[model samples]
Target: MKKLVISLALCATNSLFAQQNWLGNTSPTYEELIAHLQQLDRSHKEVKLYNMGPSDYGQPIYLCVVNGHRDSSETFEKARQSTTILINNAIHPGEPDGINACLIWLDQWIRAGKPLKSHDGGDLPVIAFIPAYNVGGMYNRSSTSRANQNGPEEYGFRGSTKNLDLNRDFTKMDAVNTYTFVKIFQALDPDIFIDNHVSNGADYPYTLTYISSMKERLAPSMQALTYAHCIPTIKDYCQIGNFELFPYVELKGETPEEGIVAFNDLPRYAMGYASLFHSLSFTVETHMLKPFPERVKATLQFMNATIAYAIGNAERIEIARKEAIQWSQAQTYFRFNYQMNEQVKDSIRFKGYKAVYPIHPITGLAQLEYDRKQPYEKYIPYYHFYISQDSIAVPKYYIVGGQETKVIASLKANGVEFQTLDSFETKTVTCQFVKSYKAPTRPYEGHFKLSEIEIASSEQAILLKPGDILIPAQQERAYFIHAVLQAKAEDSYFTWNFFDSYLQQKEYFSAYVFKAQIEDLLSKNPELKKSYEEKKALDIKFAQSEWDQLFYIYQRSPYFEQTFMRLPVYELND
Candidate 1:
């Protein structure tokens, strides 16, 4: 046992050493990444640097779009034509492995002065690399930088005013300069997105390479495809982690025991926004905890593989990418030029996660969790989620609560004005396309089309046919229920009485809670249990209850219904 720990430590150190050597192993400040990008641009005509937006720290977050062809607005919406690979590094500033890989990839691709043609047999894939995600954090100090970039890393993190863990802050849009990089994304949509970050450390050799949970149309295997078509170049050279289970090869939201089933962490999310609304996105995590050199090697391996992934899956890849950008450009909820965010949740660590964040006057934060355990050698495949471009819309941005003060700051920063409407002023609200969903009472796949929907609430919050509804205003302590029950992946888009930004958690937490409660209640009541035993008959009521609840909230709030549901409106008997 002791020997194992020592071995892990040694591996980590060696990896770090290699990582440092790769990109010159120097810790770059926001300025350095920019300078490196500029140098790449100056040397290569194929690479063009476009500024996305300023980050929180008032630094210019650059969007490096590399290709021989210029992207016009008309071609921007056409996903069939352009196949883009979006790469982001340093979202967690302390993790520098990805940035080095990014820098190296740029140098190798554009070929500076002699750049004659594209990489692929003449038609190279277009790549968008945002080397630094959290310029604010990147500018800060690193206990492990080995070399400093942003003024010695000492002034980078005070944790006050900037109390944000950037990853967590995604749900709350910020008007700060850091958002600049993201702005272009909304404008020019890319095909495949890879948001990069370093893992905590190398304690786990498996703490590397992540594939985001994406729409079914995207991959035969997110991680596997990365391995098969994209990431193989660096697999041996760089330590990689694949999303697998202990024994099962199938992808599922729950285990035999029933718990929160989480997918990839940062890359999962960064790309999720794209996937959920329309784009195919993936997050890549290189284990920084490994020796820096190892991390760099792994990151470079990922970069190479990612380019190949886009190339290998060129046709479908274009469909997914164009769909994302065009969808974003014309997306109902995402179109407002306003930023949208969702809370990430976990079940074991943070059980019973809910989107209970209220609107206006009472702001509570929507929490998120990333980096759950990677199943051992026995790996289970993931059941992909549905991402539709149905287009939900919101007219005016409403602050769900005071807790959303940061949201307000961000909203205001983005130039969005929010007015707290009295019952009369509640006339305007956000509208979005919520794909329709219907799940069986017995365990089954939920089915529904992506439809346009709006949300606001006075009596009840806006509702969707919730897949795994977690009810009861209170709990006996989150995630404590043993033998928790759960709904399948198809049972997503559940009921909620409140709103925040959005939190794309496992959806397992709420499912487990609701499944557990329902299963328990049916077991306890003979009549009710017997009635529910005929799940097909009872499912109508279960689903209706959900729609009805949401209907009440929508009717109460200024937001109106955008789609149809079997909601209970009145009782003839009453």
Candidate 2:
């Protein structure tokens, strides 16, 4: 180990010294970045670059591992067993601070003799990074994409080749990049996960801001480890590096003076997806107003601090993750639909510039801007509490219909364990029916994303056909399963349009033809007859319209389609 470290140090100093290309107001192109990493992989055995999978742009997404075992399989195995930190860069390719920061970290580590131990003599964690996640965006580079960003000569666009925001593709898995990302993420199974980006909000004095996984969404062990241990430790380390760490500036109202709220890290985002499986997830946001070099430096400092934290607390992290997995398996209910509790507020000492609205000379409109000359430091209301509006009783197993191939593929990609039924069978299970939902008028991330979802559940005897998948809730990925399968969860597959076909009424009855059947349907069922009479008596519109009366009775009749609004996923409680 000593010899290898010394050799790496010599290689770093002599042949592969730290390059200045990433140190200024410039970022590397996709080809240049890959070629550099490939060179490093060839030069040092500790550095390993793997072509995980292809992106939407037809280019392969790469995972670069530092301090790995010599062989590919063994390196991944070591990462899974030991403490690991996985940094994902350039998800939004325009925010390339992480890419430069990671490069600088590699250079500095190699030059520092590649120490294998922390300051307290604990083993250093495995460090892995996805050099550039959005390959298409990285290739389509320009300077004008980020109009408000400071001093990057050129950068990639925010959208992928498919014109989808890759950040929002995590739960939906619409882009090939998401699949590759899942492959990389599951392979590493890192204890700490970071997605790097630049901020797009109010001007804050702090250059570095981080968004941790929402506390309500995390398992108890993970929640404590993240908020009580990891964050505080990283903040101290950042302070030591001559920088301050703050929460992401997600404004409560319009500006910082009104206060900031904790970011709701829904499963659609990269960090939130990682948190589902108990990774200590964070999104690093460098102030976009800061110079490119300054942002890069701050990002690098954060990386160092996080790595230092992982090194010092490797055992604790591993234990917390293990406990989290167990906690997930033991969960009786899965809570979601988290809304920020505006009424509950804590105070944080914030340093920010005064918000000023001035008339724009070009447009003759009042523009909101931060006054650099009027910086202030004071306590501000920080609304960090989030309350889960709903929760579902977790089932023993979830049986997904055979036709839901896309959802099955997504679950498989995330390493969810399940058994495929070989033959048909019948079992009583709890199924969710879509009561109501609102879809966006316009497309979001290539989907008419669903919202305001209300669901109703009932016990039903469902026939399990051949090729149907039964996923046990007593597995390591239970949290992930619940996050996607629960129809009303904010980022569930249903919300992402995975089960849109089921939402549509596949079959409809002609009002004239069904009118004859409605009389017999109500006559045979006394309860239905009473309800129909009550509806006609109470509602003037129902009494007046023949089609409405006939259709309403027809929908409740036995001839109506059973699977019209029923979800393909069924839960087995017993």
Candidate 3:
């Protein structure tokens, strides 16, 4: 009877462990995930969970720290001081492989007595992960959202409660979740960062894919470490785990056979945001068609590999990041507007299924589909090289207008150091005027995003008031400062519609009212009169239209508002 009782107890314990361990194609709901993590925190001294801040859903976003110091405060401090790896999960909650992977990692770590050293006997880096980033999306759970994804019995939606894509809110920081994320990110100052995801594209055999920071955007030391060491080492490590890893299949053409291109990690992306701060960043994208269990395991393998790499190369990673930060601070020119060089291409061994166009039985229309039976291995063109189309000379300081509260908040959230003016002052600074731009007809992520922006700069004496921010460019976050402050950058505040108000002509004069002043305005300035006469002589449109001629003079005259079309950001050159 005693033996039987003991055996029954052992079986029950094993069953409980099996349930906790993510063994199937299901991810936990937000509450379930947090509860499980709370349990882990309660049970283990090595695990610590902190309620970092609130998400858009009014729920507290939590951060789980593993292999840290004794207390929560110490753990965070140690994370900032030591080599750390941060894994972000469920930014797109539909891609919940990372959530399960992290849970499984915790279970395995606990089972192994929570080893604090890697297999090679090096000290383990502080491992941290946000169990579920999009708490709002996590609450809006369903199976039908990700129509192409295979087997997560149920999962969260891609958009937050506000119907915003959290991934794109990193730089603009429109979502409350982004503020919380920035808080978590700044607190940790992690050496390595990974944002897990799932890919939706042409069929591929590989279960997992990865996107690294664009090579052209990274500091030289980080570029070398990421390309020369981390990725290759992690690839080898993943191979040892009986899986294949490949670059994300951002296609050059519609089908895999055509070719693949490297992902352009803009500042709006999570990985790209982290990269700006000199963190070795990556985005893991498992194939959508693969089973969730398989994807979860692959994600787990990647986490393990990344942690292993961090452990082995902690010193090198630290040194490289330090060097990268210093390199950013000492830079004289910041290059951006990266365009992929199509002429320069490298070949990679790609495994893909033949794309077939077959008539649908119901629709009776030919639809593109991947033929699973026709899997092929071949060398495909991989266009990975990028060249900067624009460069700006670094400025000593950037002065943001006091009225730009939202922009200042975002800068502060990203831990940018700045001095706030207590009194009004005037300084000669370089100011940008919007030369031209185009806005999309439709709203994207709640914004009529501006693009194709052209800017013209002039040195002007500007009055700075109290609360105006003066941010020095020579700092650790110099790259981030430049990426957003520069008017023409791909993901600048201007591009994201932050400066939309400045683009509009706020105080406009009617054609009839302005006509009376044109003669007197042009007569007061001889150069203006000469130019007006030259325009009338040279151009038929100007000569033919009385309103155009008068309006041109009105625009050139002092009556026109100087602040119209002028960006609030000003630069002080060294």
Candidate 4:
């Protein structure tokens, strides 16, 4: 037993040395993270490692599930029966404080015999965390990624191995990491989720702040507990620990004092994704301007406070989540496309440094600046409410063709309850035909996203083959189903270029052949000719370009592929 302890200590020592050399300031590398988890597994009976799917860089993601038992089944059974808190670390590898902080927290937790218990003497909330979410990003290390961050000496880059921001890829499921993450997320179904990050936009006096899941979007059952109990309790805990807390200091026009608004956490972001599950989630944003050590310490404090709160209210949280699941299953209309409600006023006593402008030597222009020496406090009107501007009625079911392998793979990764059609069958389906869509002028996160979406739908009989997928809308993940399936939803697969094939015209007619075809096409149909003439009259470009006229005529004729504008997924009527 003593030899085992000695061996584990030596392994930990070697791993710590490797981490310090690789990261330069205590942030763990991918190798060190694996090593640390191994050591924890050996040293404590409470630790269990769950392997997720491979990342884009071909490394497996791991979730550490900690409880009072050595058996994995027992631990997971307890998690299912009680409450669970999931902490995700090092998503943006450049912001690695959470990685180191969680490591330290674990060491302390083990030393203290893992005495986490619920207030009523029931089982404590099970703690689960991804040691390092973006393995590729962590290994792709550098010294210059985050220019404003202090004293990391060297840190990992923000982009994953594919050079995509994983944060923005959550709802899109572009990267393999995001795909694996969805699997892990649905499997655990944590009551509380904390995604650790570092803030780069605005400099403030507070070392630790967080962006909560939009209260309006959170289910009513969980909303009151989050706003009234959990947040306030954690805020108090931070204050008592000598680290002040505040809402994430979002700014506009260069400074926070100019009136801060709530973070528009579209489904692409972690918090927004968690909100879909009605899980109380937060994005812990440590100040980037602070020293790395200070930032890590503050993050540890914040995490500790969060765990304490979760433990205290485990039963209540569990009940809230159950209620939320039932509420979602019964929901027919789900809201999307949220906008901030500036009219509904609320305030936060912001602790910040005074802002000033100074001339830049290179540009000879005034630059915005903040003076940390001149600290000030004021009641700033904070608009944190998000009004859901648009909504979509829930569909009965979604059918995907066999050709959409990528979409099928994403559905599988997200644990979307689906079944493959056993044989070819024809059925009446409500289908959307794309009219027109516009991609961004420039690439974002390695793909040109279509933002301007327009579609037309009709009920028609469609064939479903053996490999096609059938996804029902009635499930625990109903809201997520709505978000991913809705074409115009901000982060839908359509917006992420999943259905790019539909945007292209696979069949076309030659100009010479179409000239004769157009005369016949227009002469037979007076209404079509009248519409073409009106279009030509209304737009000079249409009138001047003879080629455009012929192409339009051909498009209206049988030359265009009928399936060209059709989305892969079809809706089945109940």
Candidate 5:
């Protein structure tokens, strides 16, 4: 009888393990999530799980590979030839719908034993999944952070371990998560990239919506297919799956009906980063007002639609992407710092519930109130067109000073093709001298990014020392190179405070010592004295302040470092 009881207990334990306890119709803790992913990999030959890399807080990030043709190692190269899709979940860990949704999709797909078909008719398109991108943030679980979001009993925080928003750190790459992400991205070289998220603005009827990489900014070969085919097909698929989908709603003053503007995604954003590589990218946003399970279902439907569309249109997308790459190689210049072209506009049929301003009982101030009973649809102006107001000529190579280690590391991280100079030599090179640039008074994405910059270019003889990097602009990473090196770019390293040390004077002269130097400077040079006296006579402040006068004289002197204000990148011609 005791032996019989032992056998029964063992059977019961096995049955309990088989149950879907990991996915409890809601968010799962990081440990439980990993356990489920491992289980899927073990059970299915087509699915594999990999630890991407260590997160900021010593947690290992994981990625799931689902290929239809064969085992993971056996078919990666074959999978690459076909359309590859990369889906990232839980970037903001508080938005945990994607985590649960991805788990459900993998479970069902694996159970069905169906593999994705390829456009090449040989191997299948691979699904590269980053289960939870912000691992540190995902493990830092909390229930109160997402106060407005409806039903996930508990979830993670918005910020990473170091309190950095990983979304904004794509370009700056301050977090370890981003660095590891680069490894995964380069390895997959995906044809399509999707980042899952939850919306936090005005409530709308649509359960699922997406922000595509701006159409105007997309490669010429891809512009037509994106709007005319991919978008519409995905919309139809999602609708068929019983999920209402729409273009991402950008609200103005808590009212979406006021009209929406196309979100300008800079390199700092995931979509923008993917756009630089000519990849079709999107950001999936589910309605935060809905229940967690509903949001998860909506996200699942969106992912399914995305995969279906990618698989069906694989050949066309591949052709367009290759054409785009070919066109990019022939390009000689890159534009930056785009602004909305108000003169040009398109219309999107928008659907939303009515919202009104009402006095809040707590704060006694006007607040937005949405009435679900009243619903309407209308064509609204979408300022989707953008014109690049500034442009930089693509140089054959960019020479970076050996001392700029930070710049070198970033260039390498972005996959910029570069080589080190063998020997120290003085060469006449064209370079930009930073005249003036404005930094925002308030911090944006943990940075007071530079903007509205002015530069003066001149041909000067500079030393190209050994170990200095020579970055070539004739490769795939040309767009990224131009964007980051150009001072005018809003998302450049210069704007992100990477080269801030150069902005300040490392060496200075005392006012007492400068007075004597100024007197000698004025006496020796007639042109200098004339210019200085005229300036002093014209401006009362210059004449009255002895410190200002001395500083002005000091600036005109050779003692001031000429290279101090100049950008490190030196342009080389073909």
Candidate 6:
């Protein structure tokens, strides 16, 4: 009887985990979630789970991989021609909803064994899951015994302790331990990717924000199906802000870096890494400060809808994504996407480029000419570089961590003066409350209001004391860091960088035009040129280099068969 009881208990335990406990109302702790994933891995050999490496706070992050093709799922093909889909959640533990939602998604695709009927019985695509991208921040113990962080942030535990916003690191890639995992991910070229995050505060902003760095016309069509099937809760709450929230929208011609494609928007870093290397990607955001259940529901809706959208339109999206590759090849002004504003009173101003020069990836150099013709006043004359996409020159402003002083000093040597002041020490407070009477007037519950309070940095108490505002617990962003930067053409390296980038960036802007524009030629206008034969040879060399790297990877995998399918479609013929 004792033997039989123990055996039955073991079976029961296994069976219990197999059930769909992920999306359920009862939340699971980090350990519980990890254990459940392990248990599921046993049943689904297709799902591979790994730790991207532990966090500074001593928590092991769980990264799950789901190979898309049935035939190539297990063994490595000669050409590891696979598209990786990386999704992560819970950078801030209090925003555990995204993590749970991701778990629910894992359960649906892995255990529920959803049929591929939608794919015409084709193999599903592979996925590289970083469900809790911010494991350390999310799992670190809060002042309260709560499983995840909750807000009225000042009321939440360790409210300001999570100073390292992982989102900002996308372009910077400065995190060492993180680079180890990132290097592995880099090896596998991902086709599509998304990073999940929760938004804080009163309005509980509902809309999904895609990195607006993508070309305008294609952005909507690419995300078409995703918006279709979202659960009403998320769909109803959805607000479509591509690159940024306020500045990018309100200021005409301002080519602000709000999307993932910029220096390193974390989502942009991940997605842009995929896109630049030739793949499709996404960055996901869900409002966090709203009621807990609401956030989870919306996140899950977004996830499921996204998966379903990918599955349903896999063939179509694949073609559209491929078209993007073609579009990228023949374009000029390749860096920023420009939107012309007609609301100006008189003389049409030069708004910023919709895109900017592509980063060299290694040297971290983004020297560009100061385009006097740039549309946005704020964006003019200054070139941009992100350590990862969202993070600006961290070393120059404040000591977020590590040694960034040199990075700041370099910019200053170039004449960019910025400062990082702690809220407690510096008394210059600029917390403004703007009133809105828009029809959708969200009863404005205030967020971003930072107050002063005295509290020990112990893990026992809620991170902040009463009356403390939610300003930077040392988190900083001040755009107007320095005074006006006006300079003449001859003395400025910005002029050279800008002209060089301007020529190399566009498909037609050639080396011939590059110099002639400053000298012989008159037209600085982007439209007048149709094609350039002078730089045709150079462009081919650059394009061939990109193609060769891609083909080299495909040559080594079971996907070598695809080479025949893809190779014959040589773009060189044109």
Best by lDDT: 3
For model 6, where is the 10-residue window of minimal lDDT?
565-574
TM-scores of the candidates in the order shown: 0.49, 0.96, 0.96, 0.90, 0.91, 0.46
Per-residue accuracy of model 4 over 509-565 as CA lDDT, tens digit each: 788877877878788989889999999999999899989988777777766677878
Better of 4 and 5 by TM-score: 5
lDDT of 5 by residue, 298-327 (tens): 888888888888767788999988887777
Which residue pairs show collisions in model 5? none
Model 2: clashing residue pairs? none
Residue 321 in candidate 1, Cα distance off native in Å: 5.5
lDDT of 2 by residue, 48-130 (tens): 88998899999999999998754484348888888899999999999999999999888777668878887678787889999
Q: For model 6, what is the error of residue 395's alpha carbon versus the real structure, in angstroms, after optimal superposition?
A: 29
TM-score of 2: 0.96
True-structure lDDT of candidate 3? 0.91
- The full ranking of all candidates by lDDT, starting with the best, is 3, 2, 4, 5, 1, 6
Candidate 2, lDDT over the whole model: 0.90
**TM-score: model 4 vs. ground truth:** 0.90
Stretches > 4 Å off in candidate 6: 1-29, 53-61, 67-84, 110-122, 143-163, 201-279, 326-574
- Tens digit of lDDT per residue, candidate 3, span 169-255? 889898999999999899899999999999999898999999999999999999999999999999999889888889999999999
Evaluation by lDDT, superior candidate among 2 and 4: 2
Task: Evaluate all candidate structures by whole-model CA lDDT and list the values in order.
Answer: 0.43, 0.90, 0.91, 0.82, 0.80, 0.39
